[model samples]
Target: MLQESHTAVIARGQHWRGEVATEPYEAAWAKEAIFFLRALKVEGSLQGTRANIQISADGIHWADEGSSLAVPTTAGEVTFCRISHFGGFLRLVVALPEGARIQVVASLNLKA
Candidate 1:
């Protein structure tokens, strides 16, 4: 099971990586899942730049699941991403435009 608490940054910058592993491995699989990704805060000046979020079942391979939300610097905070119709163990990876430093928070909800 994944902890309810937020996991901190595994890496920061243009390319960031983070992973959440399921314990008691057999129970991790679910019929449906939703992942909530929130950009808690951003730094290092995000002028005319955007960020991209990606997910992978295995860390080595990744596919663009698409951004659930995008926050232009001029807009308010709280960017989100949602991935539905997924099963098995999962991992998330974030890619920011060059020279962008940002921190995001994410959580997972599973339904059997």
Candidate 2:
């Protein structure tokens, strides 16, 4: 069978200084997805830079799927997490400590 897949750049070279959520992407057709966050530059504390996976039906409200992505802290490092059984929309809620910041890119890959 021919597989269909797509990738969305949720965040591009963006600087996150505090807790923030990546822009949600609609992927209802996908049977699987992988969320990636790459830290190109880091500042302040190195630990506790993680994200909570969230799903939404209408792309409006969201709830944690009880899964978290352990993001890389050092530059030139990448980390990802796979997810399934999702809703129409998906996003990651990243938590950053006070005075902590990271320049990174986030992407979501979908497969059907």
* Winner by TM-score: 2
Provide the clash count, candidate 1.
0
Could you tell me how far off, in angstroms, the CA of residue 63 lies in candidate 1 after the best superposition? 4.2
For 1-112, candidate 2 gives per-residue lDDT tens digits of 7999998999999998878998889999999999988998988885866789999988899999888887678998899999999968999997788888899899999999
Candidate 1 segments whose C-alpha is farther than 4 A from its true place: 1-28, 44-76
TM-score, candidate number 2: 0.95
Q: Name the regions of candidate 2 deviating beyond 4 angstroms.
A: none
Give each model's whole-structure lDDT.
0.43, 0.88
Q: What's the TM-score of every candidate structure?
A: 0.48, 0.95
